[model samples]
Every structure is written in C-alpha cells, then in structure tokens.
Target: MKRILLLLSLLTIAGVSAAQEFSGNIALESLIFSEPGLDASQMDDNITLSFKPKWTGEWNDGDDAWSVEIFLRADNRDEGREHADIRELLWLHLDGDNEWRVGINTMFWGVTESQHLVDVINQVDQVEGIDGEDKLGQPMIHLKQYHDWGVLDFLVLPGFRERTFQAAQGRLRFPIVVDTSAPIYDSSDEDNHVDYAFRFSQTYGDLDLGVSLFKGTNRDPQFDLGPGIPHYVQMTQVALDLLLIADDWIWKLEIIHRDTDPSAYQALTGGFEYTFYGVYDSDINIGSLAEYSYDSRDEGQRGVFDRDLFVGARLAFNDAQSSELLAGIIYDTEKHSQSFRLEGNRRFGDSWKGTIEMQVFSNVDPSDPLAAFEKDDFLLLEIARFF
Candidate 1:
C-alpha cells in the first residue's frame, strides 16, 4: 500500500503544476471451443470492464528530474476460473530516458511456444523501457522509460520463494507423484496446479527476456494434452522480438527459448526444452503461426531433448469474428515417435472468445514405459474475455 501511495503522491505533484487527464478502454467477448476428451458443454459468453484516470508532468527541480504514471485494472468475468483478479500497472521515468515499469503484460508472453521468444527479448532488452497504458489502452502508466534515444535500467529480485501444492480438484494435466515410473505424471490426481514460482526478468530493447523457475499449480497452469498435472517445472525463458513498421505492411520476427521439468516431486527433476520461432505480416491480423519445439524425458533417463514443428494462423473473419489457429507436430527422437496438435480460437461479438484444441500422439515403442499412456488423442475448449 505504501508503494501505491507514494506513486499517487508523485502523480499528484506532477499534476499540481499542470493538467490532469482521464480515459478508459473496454473489450469483452464470449464463445465455446472443443473440450479435450470430455463432454462438450454449451457455448457461453461473458463480460469484463476496465476504468482508469491518469496524470503526467515534467518536474525539473534543479538537478532532480522526475515523471510518473499509475493505474488500476479490475475484471469480473464468467469464463475466468479465479472469478477475478485486480492488478496494477506502474511506470516511472527519471532523468532523460531511464525508467521503471511493473504489471501484467500478456502481450509480453503468450501460451504458445512460438510466441515465447518475444517475451525473452522483451525482458533482456527492456533495459528499463515500455510504451504502456491501462487495460483500456489509455496512457495510464508511463515511467518515461525511454526518450528520443534509449533506456537505462536496473533489476531487484533478492531471494526466492518456494511452495509445494497438489492437484486437489481440477483436471488440467496428469498428477505428479514424488517419484513416478511413468512418462506422464499420475493420471488419478490430474489437475492444473501451481506449486511455486521463482521468477525474474530484464529488458534491453525491442527485446525482452524473462526467466521463471517454479513449481506448477492452479487449474490455469495445467496442460491441454492430458489432465493438468501438479508438476515441478524448472522453467527458463528468453525472447527477442522485432517490429518493423512500413508504409503498407508491418513485419515482425520473434524467437523464444524454454527449458522445463514435467514432474516436480521426483528426486531429480530433468525434463524437456521447447523453442519457438514466429513470423507475422504487418497488415494481417490472422498472421501465420509457425514454431519448432521439442521435449525429451524417459523412464530411467531423467532428461533428453527432442524437436517439433508448428504451423497455424491468427485469422480474423470480420470485424465481429476473429480466431487463432495453431497446428504443429512433435517429434520423439528416441524411437522416432511423432505427435500432432490442432488448436483454434474464435471471438464472438466484441467481448468473448472461445478456444478449441485437440492433440494426437502416436508411438508403439515397447521400450519406453512412459509411452504406454500416450493416448492417440485428446481435446480442450475454453472461453475468455478482456475488459
């Protein structure tokens, strides 16, 4: 709370010398996708809202230079499993182009491996910079992290926090026992659970990089292939994205790297590493999706590395209809096994979006015990809204 107050005070001081501005944004959607290997439910839509007021100023107190921005975002929607979570975005700039920023930036990292590199580069390149606003897209938080030239920054993350949780209720992925003899976690305790998160990130330029070392938890954290499992994931992420704006088209190139452990309770947690490469056209909304990802983990072999291919698109049918398509193939290196996936996202009206996903795994390797439960198929569906 003190930090919030201090931020408000700075905003007040900046406003006293000049003017105050108020603005907001709203976007909501609803729809339904295919549920993974379960009874399909009826389609549904939801609502969410965001409001913000902002104040900005240039204070030149002798050698003391300052700038500040503060904002608040609250949302309520039926599609959300947590119901609601109110978050804040704070940005402050000092001297010329150096600044500070804090908040949840979804455009930072996405659910797919192809989009992962964008987050990493954003972290490593941030060096302290971002063009940000409230959930409404209004200029709510601005730390002047950048000026005409570049940015200056620092990172502060002292110790780490650790927690061990269980998949008590939901079913997002397989359950992970302390030591399991199977490739997939135990299916009985299937639920997407978030155990703990030890994360840190930094920025350089058009590049952002973030690293999170933690256990998995929450229904939201589960995998779509199987019931979400409560696994210990030692995750590391790096992303680099470049956006080029031209007269008629925009060109974007991004790369991401990730290494994760599928099981947490095991004595030695060694798992798979997935990498992504994404390219999008400047003028198209349903930009193409192409990615390369791989994973390697076996019975006695705690870890190995495999590669996969991804292809799809973020297609928009019209002003009121929008959808994203993600399709790819995963390659099992050991026995040359292979898997394929099809994921779809659709938006209804302006406030609701539905996601439908499906996966098929194929392998008859008798030597791999984990391959036993590799079902030839699976599916998932979800509805999400933004305000």
Candidate 2:
C-alpha cells in the first residue's frame, strides 16, 4: 500500500503540473469495550478519529481531451489502529463521452456503494495494509470510450501473454525499451494482450439495464494469497457482470466460474454465491440479505454451505439523532453457531455535543467458543467537532 501511495505521488509529478483544489473533513469517535474474556480489564472509554483531504487538478492537450480529479481519504482508527482505503475519481472530456476504467477502480464500480469518501479517509489513517510483496505485479492503466450504444476499453499495459509468460517467475517481466520519441508498451503481443471487457448500458423509466462482457481477473482479489504464492499461480474472474436497477430494487447478477488452485485468491470472485436484494431510504428503512462467501482464509475456516438470511434497519429520530439495528439467522456459514447483532447511535447537547452508540455480537451455539460474546459487548460515546 505504501508503494501505491508513493506511485500516485510520482504519477502526479510525472504529468504536466498544474495548481489543484481541495476539500474534505475530519471526525473523532469515542468508544467503550466490554468483551467477556478481556472485559474484566477494559478501558472506560476510547477515542477513534478520521481525517481526509482532496486533490482537484487537470491537464489538457489543445482541444482534444483533458482529465480532472478530486481524491480524499483517512487511514487509521483510534488514532491509527485500522487500515485505510482510497476513495475518489471524477473525470471529464472536452469532446465526446468517456466511461470506464480498469484496475482497482473497476473493483469499486462492480460493487454498489456511496461510502468511498469515507473509505479514502480511512485509508489515509491506516499504516498497515496489503503486505509489500503481495502488491499487484502489474500496474495497469485502462480506459473506455463510447460510440452509439456499444463500448470499448483497452487494458493496456506492459507486454502481453507471450512475453509475459516467458518472463514469468522472473523479476524482469516489465521490460522497458527506450525510443527517441517516448516509451510505450510494445503492443506487439497485442493478441495475447486480451481486451478483457465490453459493456453496454441504457435506461428505461425507473428501471436500468447494463451488460458487461470482459475478461475479468479472478473473483477473490489475489492480495489474500499471501507472499508465498508465485505470481503465475494467480486466478482470474473471467465472466460477465450483469446489473439491473428498478426503483427501490437493486440486483447484481454475476456469472463467474473459477480455475482451481489453493487458497481464496486462486478462485474467481463468486466462490461464496449470493443472489438477493433489498432496498432502504435516505435516512431510515429496512432490508433483507441472503448470501454466502467461501471465506476459508482464517484458521476458523467453515465448509462451503455457510448461508445467511438476515434483515437490517436504520432510523433517524430527527436531523440530529439516529439509530441502526440488524438481526439474522445463518446456517453452515454457522451450522455450529447462530449469529446476531444490535447497534445504535444518537447525538445530544447544546454547547457540549456528544454521540452515543452501542454494539452487541452473539452466537447461538452454546458449545461454540464464540458463544460467550452473546453475553458480552461494547458501548461508545463520542463528542467532537467537524470543520
């Protein structure tokens, strides 16, 4: 992750320099813990804070095209206890339309979310992240353009399949050739250099339809593989990502199959299958979820049939007060133990403002080692400012 940040800085410098604009916020959260095992000796209260800033800049070439962006993030918790994630990307074009991006940015799009700014703020705060040696071997630059109803994007980068396979296991995979003009990826093996995706999207009334046909890199991100796995053994999520949205309904249909190897990273994204959707509101609403993830990374690996069906709700007493709650029954995913949770947050005071919240996690299986958590939980109250 440090290298990623370092690379971002280097890219900014390498490009034509320009003045930039910025804006964001900072927040501090106070908490209290009461875990049964460690509850006896617990802090009455703890503090967790977040900060974020942005970069708004652009570069142009005559009247052809230009790019602009504003990015922000926070990288830590309880000062710097948690990991941080990147968040932000707003682009523009002087002539036609541009829609589509590759690499990490694509991962963000595949998942529906609105907490990117919050994610970036967390990333800035996290000092610990994907171990250094586990970083993506290929640094890619992908883009998309449009013509009528069809779309096109080139996952352009160093060398293709032929050359890449030859250089596999060796550190010299990214070959550089000098030229009198400028250095460019020798697209000679362009065929083995597969053009991964082709998508088409349109709208009708409250319903929207989108189809993506691309060569997807494996499903479960490769970062989970750890540093020991050779880069060549990686998996790919080559399939179609279909999405449809109608009014309060959101559906994500992924048709992905995996290639065999060891560990979660080797399989395509859908190892744990899920297909169910529910909707909520701007402030309060309730929704249900049923999905499964073949999460076999930690020592607590459970077999494939871990299915969960649950309902979650959020409420706001008013503009300044609110609460959140969720409860569910999980099977195989928890055949041995049933699971549940409850949480709420509220704000109070005039001159001295404070936010209070509590969370409880429990397991139904008495024999399950995690059952003790049902009787023990954590509470928090935070007071701070936003500027």
Model 1's TM-score against the true structure: 0.42
Q: Write the per-residue lDDT of candidate 1 for residues 155-181, one digit (tens) a residue.
A: 332111111221222112122321111
lDDT of 2 by residue, 162-201 (tens): 1111111111011211111221222343223433434455
**How many backbone collisions does model 2 have?**
29
> Given candidate 2, what's the lDDT at residue 9?
71
Tell me how far candidate 1 lies from the true structure as C-alpha RMSD in angstroms: 12.2
Worst 10-residue lDDT window for candidate 2 reads: 114-123
Evaluated at residue 381, the lDDT of candidate 2 is 57
How does each model score on lDDT? 0.35, 0.35
